[model samples]
Target: MHPSTPTITAQPSRPPPPPSPDKPPQTFLDLITSVLSLLLVSSLTVRSFIGRWQVIRTKLTSLQSSLSLLSDSPHWSQNPLLHTLLPSLLSTLQRLQSLSHQCTLSSFPGGKLLFQSDLDIASSSLSNHLHDLDLLLKSGVLHQSNAIVLSHPGPSSDKEELAFFVRDLFTRLQIGGVEFKKKALDSLIQILNDDEKSASLVAEEGSVGCLISLLDSHNERSIQEQAVLAVSILASGSDEARKTVFEEGGLGPLLRILDTGSMLLKEKAAIAIEVITAEPENGWAISAYGGVSLLIEACRSGSEATQTYAVGAIRNVAVVEDIKMALAEEGAVPVLVHLLVSGASAAQEKAAHCMAILASSGEYFRMLIIQEKGLQRLMDVIQSMPSSDTIEHVMRAISSLSVSDSTARILSSSTLFITRLSEFTKEGSLILQQISVSLLASLSISDGNKRAISGCVASLVKLMEVPKPAGIQEAATAALVSLLTVRSNRKELVRDEKSVMKLVQMLDPKRELVSKRFPVMVVVAVLTGGSGECRKRLLDAGAYQHLQRLEEMEVAGAKKAVQRLAGNKLKNIFSRTWRE
Candidate 1:
């Protein structure tokens, strides 16, 4: 084994070519190549780190400059700061645009939604800038509305500041001229078609009458429809404002809308008609303009709400006798009577009130009532329901009959008139009692009926003496006026200073209400009818000062009768005594 190992060792010995010393440790080229590889790698790493550092420094500098500019220029749009930073700001925007483009290229789902959200958030900052710029511009710190508009521009404003800017710009331009009016009307017309906008805000910005005028204009039908809705709002509020809406041809369009319009437009038009026709002037206008026939047609339509509104309009229009007769001639009474008998409580009330107004027009409505036998039905309602308003209606019907030849003849020929008249004195509500007393005074026109009503004279005397509510007192004063209208009744009933003095007390402005037409007229008559003793009592009650006020009122009243008959009119009747 030893001999074999020696031989193997001897064979292997080539000394492994001892390390190369004389060869200079392998050529310098190899060493150089290794060193160069390491050096190149290190240099690459340092260069990459320096590039990253430069990028970071640039971003930080841009951020600092932007903040500095924002602080230096509060109103960047109006001031010199915008120009100063324009280049940098534009560069930043370009960079952002490039970045956004790259982000879009990634094509991530919801990425666009995220972008818009960010844009919205960014708009708030822009809004601040816009508002600041606007204040500067408005305060004369800056000039040019167009400049502000250009600074903050869009079809729609995303920023509140931009909104203010847009609003100011629009206001200035819209108020400038007819050209502006057309522009504004066109813009509003477009906005009204937008589903996302607040309708009320758009409507308020559009003038009501302007919108109303559009109905007749060559403007698009869509624009006219919007205008009709705007006027409906104007008509629904205060008296003066409603008057303006009516005077502005608002009624014409509404009636037209009633004839040809969508359900919504028709509804809005009906509401406008209701408001306009609620007052006497507007009501008369509606009738004068042939609105009554259209309203009647609308009432007959299938739409329940339309019918209700139409009823209200009709009721308001019926206040005038000619209008009432016009409605009657158009066969509106039966329709109204049907509504009263078969409709909801509101419709019924409206119908009843309308019937009362129609009935109050004397002979104009008496034939209709007598022919329809509406008297018994009305009396039934008054006796059973006993509402104050219903009572007023019943009395008005009776009052109408008092002036009606056919009705009066029927009442006098039959015991029915006397019987009903007597019961009015016996069993009636306060207002009903007042009405009955008034009817008795009217019925007392006949010598025979005078004796029948004479029993209630003491009662009337007691009613006059006692303190009463204003409405009752007014009713009593009206009854007295009616009774005193007849010279025969005035001479017989106003016999003593006691009665005259009592009437003089009613002439006291403080004690008696003079606002109502009926009571004011009655007081005028009573003072005119009083004797010497009556005039003295009137003076004691300070009637002279009240008469002076009436003379000053000069409200086309019988001044001479009040002065000559009541003893105050003569004191200052057309004299300069009170003028100074």
Candidate 2:
């Protein structure tokens, strides 16, 4: 029967085979990438939305709530919130509005009214009202803007709280809105009309124009102090802000501050000016605005801090040729020399740094110093300055000069320079010693100065014999390497096996970490930085032997150092150096 029915058998239809296995995995990867992209987009959108919304929400909440409270009170026209809730209100908005309105018509010595037993009832009532307002602002419930506007008119009384309130309010207004900012300006105008609260609130958030207005306030002392603060804040904010500060009478204000303000104010002002001159773009403005004269005046001021800041500012400005010429025209060189001679350690250090910056382009600064007979002055400071900070600054300046042919000529003329340099190698501070070593090394690189630099080789080697800071040791090693690399100085730098051995001792694994230790890799770099002749001397002096023996003995530390020195390129150096 099956054979007979075979012709009638039917074929079954089958569903198509499932997609390839690789296709599923590829789809999953695509989906993951799409999801990550979507997530990133969502996060960026959310952050932007939040930032814009926060500002709008803060303003809306402040305006709506205050306006509502004002409308709700029946006594709005009579006592107002200032009289009714002044004592109890904790909102900064209410306190600020009340204080600002009150100060517009009333007179307070600084912005406060002192309490007295025999005071009128009105005065007592006002005092109570102010006390309430003060409490409210102090609660941090109000925007900083409102608080600043309230204190802008200076003080209503000579009370200490008034001064404190003004200072605090200024700090808060740094983030306030345009209207509150206007109030701040108005408050500054009022304060300038008085002697108390003369300090202008020119923090980073405020306008430079606001600070300049203080100069017209007739209160010279207040104008001077506030101008300094404002300028400093502007200089710290942005390059555009610095430009605005200058355009809005920053130069005169800075000069006036240096002339009249306290030592602290003068110091801050000089720092601000220096910051302004730090950029190449601002060079012209600084030179044109008579910055050099002002800086020189400050450098010659009685205050050591003022001199320090002034010298630093001058140095930064002198980076430009025109600025340096202006400083020279203003007789800054004499003032700098005088500072290097008789000033405090900080002052002398700054003066040296200034001289270096000015002398960097040519022998301008060096010639000026030498012409003023300043070598003795520098020598004295190097010998007597107690702080290592000053020595560091001076050494950097001198080293920078050593790289210049013109300044080298000036240095070569002074016998005291060589003598002092030798002494510096022997007994200088860690930083000073390093800088001196680098200076000598750089000097020896040139044929003309080789003899002068050679004179200090022995002393530099001797200094390496004692226990030293890692930075000093590293610098000495680098200097010696540089000296030996040069054909002229090589023999002199590593003349003795003891000299090589001293460097080897620096490689000792037991070198403990100081509070601020040099990187061990840095020592290695210095050791190997020299040319074939010098590197051979160093290795022969047992430097390579010491490292190899330490690698075998101090396995962990040696591994670390090796790994560090190798970095990403270490593999290549390893294959080359350790090949069988």
lDDT of each: 0.54, 0.53
Give all TM-scores, in the order shown. 0.42, 0.45
RMSD, one per candidate, in order: 23.6, 29.2
Q: lDDT of candidate 2?
A: 0.53
Q: Mark the regions of model 1 whose C-alpha exceeds 4 Å error after superposition.
A: 1-206, 213-230, 261-267, 302-304, 320-325, 384-387, 405-431, 440-462, 466-580
What is the clash count for each candidate, in the order shown? 3, 9
lDDT for 523 (candidate 1): 49
- For candidate 1, the C-alpha RMSD (Å) to the true structure equals 23.6
Please name the candidate that would achieve the greatest lDDT relative to the true structure: 1
**Model 1, global lDDT:** 0.54
Q: Write the per-residue lDDT of candidate 2 for residues 454-522, one digit (tens) a residue.
A: 556655655554455555554654555454443555556556666556555656656543211222332
